[model samples]
Target: MIVHDTPLNSYYASTSWIINITIRKDNWALTKTIQSLSFCTIPNDGFFEGIELIVTSSTTPSNGDKVVIHYYGRLAAKQGWRFDSTYDHKDQNGEPLPFEFVLGSGKVISGIESAVRSMKVGGIRRVVIPPSQGYQNTSQQPIPPNFFDRQRLFTTIFNPTRLANGEGSTLIFDIELVSLRRRRKL
Candidate 1:
């Protein structure tokens, strides 16, 4: 399976204010539904992030092994709040961002690490990670200047799978598990 990595650019800075109004309106509608459903509260026991995902793959990942992941999900705000995408941006050298990560490693965020670990080859599960676990107090990639200071960031990882190496970080990929080859020789 070939995985294409894309840069997460700042969506907020690139778009005009007029376009944001429509997104904000849609976000408001979603927020209302979540509030009514009561699936809006933050999780206390598991990861503190407000996001969860169900991931499925064919091969399982071991510790210290670099597993490539390809995924696509959305970000939403917590209860009584909203996701201001205008301020949040993640891009590579000069491109819109796509999902890619090395499993079981700290290369990404804590929430992502936890969710990916709980997945198996061809398995899917929902992971809830609060803002604390998602991005916490970081002001780096994905999270823009004003958006980084906020309290939480939530995302749901859809059907995801492992990818091959040597792929550039600019391709939005739909990956499949080719195989899980061991690095050390027997």
Candidate 2:
């Protein structure tokens, strides 16, 4: 029997991982032990409490820097409930144009600002944000193109604060930090 212990640093933790196991005829005795060990379990409701962040790539950008990103937003409670996207804005070459904003700026939502602040250029992250860090009021940007879709979103799950029932709304964002540049000093 052999045990391979891999020490993972904070940097390595941001990336994905894959575990593979190989067994020979002689290892059949250990197969029962391995099979007994549970590998992964996904929840039926697909709801994870609080913020969940998965980093697909990693890079570091400083505050006050101008950064560009591509993102898709959805309602966390509803599967396939994509509310808004930047994909509509594309260049003449047919490439999706990224949204640009300064880090730490109030232009975007608090959740987005918080997520992008820790990201590096070319880093992609999926973040689930609770109402506390999400939209407390109507945001002018990223509205759905279809009137009915927009109405459904705003009426149902967009702004928790605006809802009379006081139910909370959680949002999920898949964000990719495309590039960043240092803030120019005067």
Candidate 3:
């Protein structure tokens, strides 16, 4: 039984009609179930103009939380690359950043939220986001000017949650899940 239908639900329901899903894991965990239900099989060079995920998150995560995860493979066709350099703010003498931001409020890039919404509390997965879903035509720190045009940024955020306020950096996240609450229906 499907518990809650978040953005992922709508996305999969629409995309599934055009793709085939193959479940590789038989485990009956909630994460596995959701992934099995939403998994889509497309050729590596398929005409996917937007973001795609290997697995989708079952729990709804809020801002000001963090999640831990392991590294996985990543690739960007537009960039002609397969990986990005990892940086830990806290390791660089910068304070650990919070994962808090209003969903769909443009506080963070669309790619970050899209990736996070598809992740479970303890699940680790790789995400491929085109520049249009990411920084788009804008320039920011770490992301060089016009980088979006030359290449798409491929990041691996493990168990990503939201960040709290006063924390800088827009596109990337190193977070932990502190809580998951349903938003009241209007």
- Tens digits of per-residue lDDT, candidate 3, 160-186, equal 231132221122222223334455555
TM-scores, one per candidate: 0.37, 0.61, 0.35
Write down the lDDT of every candidate, Cα atoms only: 0.33, 0.57, 0.35
**Between 1 and 2, whose lDDT is larger?**
2
CA deviation > 4 Å runs, candidate 1:
1-57, 78-99, 137-186
Report the C-alpha displacement of residue 115, candidate 1, in angstroms. Answer: 0.9
lDDT of 1 by residue, 1-186 (tens): 111121112222233112111112212522111111111122234423212122343556655655444343224322223333321345554332334345545656555555555445543232334334545334422332343433333221111121133211111111222223334545
**Candidate with the greatest lDDT versus the true structure:** 2
Residue 8 of model 3, lDDT score? 34
In angstroms, the error of model 1 at 117 is 0.8
Per-residue alpha-carbon lDDT of model 2 for 44-84, expressed as tens digits?
A: 12322212222335566777898888787787555648877
- The clash tally of candidate 3 reads 17
lDDT of 1 at 62: 56
Off by over 4 Å in 2: 1-59, 140-148, 158-164
Say which candidate scores most in TM-score: 2
Query: Which scores higher on lDDT, 2 or 3?
Result: 2
